[model samples]
Target: MKESHKDIWLKRKQLGRSRYLVLFGLLPWGLGLTVITSLIELISFQQINPVWVPARLVLFFFIGFFVANARWQAMENRFESDSQQRP
Candidate 1:
């Protein structure tokens, strides 16, 4: 089916919102993970291990996926509500 202009615009808006969420949200989350992981390693292992770098990358990827998904859902919900309100 051919898509309307409004639909195209909405999709672009949603994409932009998701990108914004993923890019901005990942920084603080990764930083917090690094700090907590470092603290744990320091207390338990008495030194920060090199393994943390890879582990952090994997964890950050998964967490970023979920966070972006959540933000997309929220944007979708808001878009639906706003569309419904339009005459």
Candidate 2:
């Protein structure tokens, strides 16, 4: 069964959970990027750079946060543009 966008948005808006969900939703993307970058470095150098892994994670964490926030804002706009609830 396919869930409608309104239902998904309602879930996100409920209990103000969207605040955290929006940001955390980017976790998989950030982690995948981090792992890919780290692996590239590992393959090139033939050794793991301990410092870079944590550094990339921290950097991407912040970056992902901002990106997620922007995405959440965009989502709000998208919903507002066409599917706003009636008062």
Candidate 3:
């Protein structure tokens, strides 16, 4: 535990600051993915289990959401840094 590990404090980890999450931009993307994927699944449901259908919908949406969000976050940070560097 960090509390007990006195040595840990001596050699403090040089971890980078955590990401600054901007929910305003990311929320729409996440919800959009959820809605779009769910609509696609609406076309058919013969193969997938009824219970798993919602689960799959949720999974696909979240995967798309997180992946897109991460990429978007990186791009946002890059653009910000680029803008700051411009004279």
Candidate 4:
């Protein structure tokens, strides 16, 4: 049996969502959060704490990851609705 158009469109939309999550959300957020937190300590104290820095970095990275996921979900919902409305 052949696949349907709706199925294909849905698959594409899912892929877009995943890509957005990884590229637009998770990666930059993780990198930015880490850098920002690290810089905060560095600038405030003029020196980085070896232990606390890595911990803070990981925490910030996860925070960014969740924010990205939320953004991607909203985009995905919009795309699905838009596709459904078209002929």
Model 3 per-residue lDDT tens digits across residues 7-85: 4422322221122122322345456655655666665752434675566556765665576557556655655665577
Please list all clashing residue pairs in model 2, or write none if there are none. none
lDDT tens digits, residues 58-79, model 1? 6876786677667667757876
- From the highest TM-score down, the ranking of the candidates is 2, 4, 1, 3
Off by over 4 Å in 4: 1-19
Model 4: per-residue Cα lDDT over 1-87, one tens digit each: 123755654665667766756666566877776777778989999987889866766776677668877765665676677767777
Q: Choose 1 or 2, whichever is better by TM-score.
A: 2
Cα lDDT over the full model 4: 0.69
Error of 2 at 60 (Å): 0.7
Model 1 alpha-carbon miss at residue 27, Å: 1.8
**Pairs of residues at least 3 apart in sequence or in different chains that clash in candidate 4:** none
Alpha-carbon deviation at 13 in model 4, angstroms: 5.9
TM-score of 1: 0.58
